[model samples]
Target: MTALVEMKDLKKTYKMGETYVKALDGINLTIKKDEFVSIVGPSGSGKSTLMNMIGCLDALDEGTYFLEGTDVSELSSSKLALIRSKKIGFIFQGFNLLSKLTALENVEMPLIYQNYSHKNRKKKAIEALEKVGLGDRLHHKPTELSGGQQQRVAIARALVADPPIILADEPTGNLDSKSGKEIMDMLVDLHKQGNTIILITHDTYIANTARRKIVLKDGKITEDVEVS
Candidate 1:
């Protein structure tokens, strides 16, 4: 498998008042194309920090990060944003949908930044929504949908741009067990269909849904294993 993401000697620190917290301590990781991997850890274990670094949402204090062979660790914010928009799709636990926009509009948000025509954006958004089994709810607002449906919208939004990597941060955290299971199934199907999925979650069951599990603790990775 070709390497899609590579990190070496990654480090990050935060100043908490009079104290310094080592959020990430000399981390090194590599994720390959078409792989489904879960990063699991308890609270304050640096999972979120690592996610931010991988997603290009935050800069690391010291390290080299290569995404698709391009160095992204030292890029300017605008450059990083461009890289993120083109290569990475993000799904958050909160569903992050705009309350006033309908599902179709929300899914079209990413393309709007890329100078997509209105017709093209609408067409792609509809296709993505259909992929996530939300075609019938395209015009519904987030408030009108259930938590699961809202998450489907989020997934559609992430997929509409056809990004190479999907960064799902606790995607099922806000749903009931049944809904969460459905979301996990969708993610698994996505992985099979060639999307490189990086799932960040603390739930053991959710972590195991991926083919590979990476455990983090005290700002370091303690275990990296493949599941059968």
Candidate 2:
């Protein structure tokens, strides 16, 4: 099978004062289309660093990284932003919604970046909310929605662009158990429908929901296992 993502001897480092922190070191991995992957690690295990690199939110210090078969390290900053906009969708632990925007408008934001016409953007945004089972909550502001509902809106925003890959950072972290389960169910549903999903979480139970789990420790992968 062809890989949607491939990392070859990838390393990321940061400097603080006179010390250097190795956030990711010589990590080699691959994820094919339609696969759901869970990254599990401790708070300081470099999972967040890896997630940022994988999400194209940060650049790698060394090694080769490819997404959709394109070498990301070679792209210019502007080109990289274009690539990210075209290929990736992101969900975060925080809802990150604009307080002034409604759920529908939040979902419409990505399309605005893509320069889509207003009519088409609204159409697509509504469809995305419908897909996330939030069609009826389109006009609700973030404050008016429950935590799970807000998360569903976030997922809808992630889907609006119809990007093949979704990089979610601690997607279910802020919700209660019931809300977390609902969010997990939506993720599984999306995966079943052939979305490529990579979820970062510290919760083992949440990680178990994915087909494969990669455990990181001290900026290195300590274990890689398939659960399904």
Candidate 3:
């Protein structure tokens, strides 16, 4: 597999009151295309910071980050937003769906930024919703859906554009055990279908579900190992 993401000497620091917190400490890592990886850490372990760096949601204090060969570390916020919309799909723990939008409409959000015509967007959104088993609920608002269903909508929205990389941050954090397992299964199936998935979670079971796991502690990677 080709390298989809690469980071060398990655570092980020935040000033909290009188102390400086090192969110990422000289980290070096790489993720390949079609690989399923889980980044797991305890609270304050810099898991969120690392995900931000990888997702282009925030810049690093120091390091070189190459996403499919493009150096994104120093790109302007606007450029980073473009890269995010074009190259990455994000699934968050909170089902970040618009309250007034139906499942289909929510799924079409990403394509709107890409200037997709209304007809094409609707067609694609329906297909994505169907792919996630939400075809019957396309017109239902988020408030009318269950937690799992809402998350399915989010997943549909994330993949509607067919972005190469999926950055899922605690995707199942809000679901029940069964729903969480279902979501994880969906992610596994997605991985099998050739999407590079980067999952950020603190749950050991969830972390082990991936093909590889990277354990972080004190802003540094303590272990990088194959799941078996």
Where is model 2 more than 4 Å wrong at Cα?
A: none
Residue 192's lDDT in candidate 3 = 94
RMSD of each: 0.9, 1.1, 0.9
* Residue-wise C-alpha lDDT for candidate 1, range 1-228, written one tens digit per residue: 448999999999999999999999989999999989999999899999999999999988998889999899768988998888888999999999999999999999999988899999999999999999998999999999999999999999998899999999999999999999999999999999999999999998899989999999999999999977
> What TM-score number comes out for model 1?
0.98
Candidates 2 and 3 compared: the better one by TM-score is 3
For candidate 2, the TM-score is 0.97
For model 2, residues 26-120, the per-residue Cα lDDT tens digits are 99989899889999998989999998888788899889999988898888888887777768888999978898999999999989888899999
Could you give the candidate ranking by lDDT, starting with the highest? 1, 3, 2
Sort the predicted structures by TM-score, highest score first. Answer: 1, 3, 2
Clashing pairs in 2: none
lDDT of each: 0.94, 0.91, 0.94
